[model samples]
Target: TQLLEQSPQFLSIQEGENLTVYCNSSSVFSSLQWYRQEPGEGPVLLVTVVTGGEVKKLKRLTFQFGDARKDSSLHITAAQPGDTGLYLCAGARDKLVFGAGTILRVKS
Candidate 1:
């Protein structure tokens, strides 16, 4: 099985909606990095929660790492079209193991 699995795969929302994406795994990682990507562009680091149970917030988004370092989550509040992008959760050790990803679309 894949090390990481993200749910929904895709999400669509209006200008002012809330959404959450999940990342689950059976294996533990040293660290987890959440990235957001635009078309034809490299993934940009949104946050890296190293310590388990760590919670970091960026604008309308919140990220959390599981206590066992085996999973993570991303929550977005009051979404806007500007929030539209592909959200990817990747677990890393010597290398990164990525989830399929959750593509979010926020329409005005």
Candidate 2:
């Protein structure tokens, strides 16, 4: 079985702060995905990277996949209070392997 490891289990930041979350695995995946979950809601897919070294940006958020396809990162620029939530990374091959997730709390 493959496993994904996420760093900084929790993050607390003020509005306008920038932060980065990471996900790593010893196994290479065919694809990697990032998701965000709010209270009482299922995780919403944020981005997917299928190619090694791919970088994608969504509004204030940026997603990157490692050249080896074994790691990924999510960076939020000038985070707002509304960005507070749980961030997750999932690696997919025949199945999806998930990271423990990073909980972010952005305060005003």
Candidate 3:
């Protein structure tokens, strides 16, 4: 069976604060994807890394794929109130398995 588990299902941080979210799994994956979702809106793709040990960045957000493709992480250097939303990580094999999600609230 394949499964993706994300830690810290919820997080609340003050504006301009930093935070990190972790996604882990026992199964190997060819690629991994990250997405952010807002209320009443569909998830938007943040990044996708296919190679092991690959890393990508978007503005203040940093994403890393595990050396074995079994895990991933997202680090936000300075979160803002506009960043408040649900963050999701997915492991891609033959199918995409999504983690429950991490609800982040960046308070003013």
Candidate 1, residues 6-105: lDDT per residue as tens digits? 9989998898889999999989899999999999999999999999999999988999999999999999999988899999999998899899889999
Per-residue CA lDDT of candidate 3, range 1-108, in tens? 328889789999899889999999999998999999999999999999899999999999999999999999999998989989999998888888899999999999
Error of 3 at 45 (Å): 0.6
Whole-model lDDT, candidate 2? Answer: 0.96
TM-score of 2: 0.97
**lDDT per residue (tens digit) for residues 11-95 in model 2:** 9999999999999999999999999999999999999999999999999999999999999999999999999999999999799
Winner of 1 and 2 under lDDT: 2
TM-score, ranked from best to worst: 2, 3, 1
Off by over 4 Å in 1: none
| Candidate ranking (lDDT, best to worst) | 2, 1, 3
- The Cα error of candidate 3 at residue 85, in Å, is 0.5
TM-score of each: 0.96, 0.97, 0.96
Tell me, by lDDT, which candidate is best. 2
The local lDDT score (0 to 100) that residue 6 gets in candidate 3 is 90
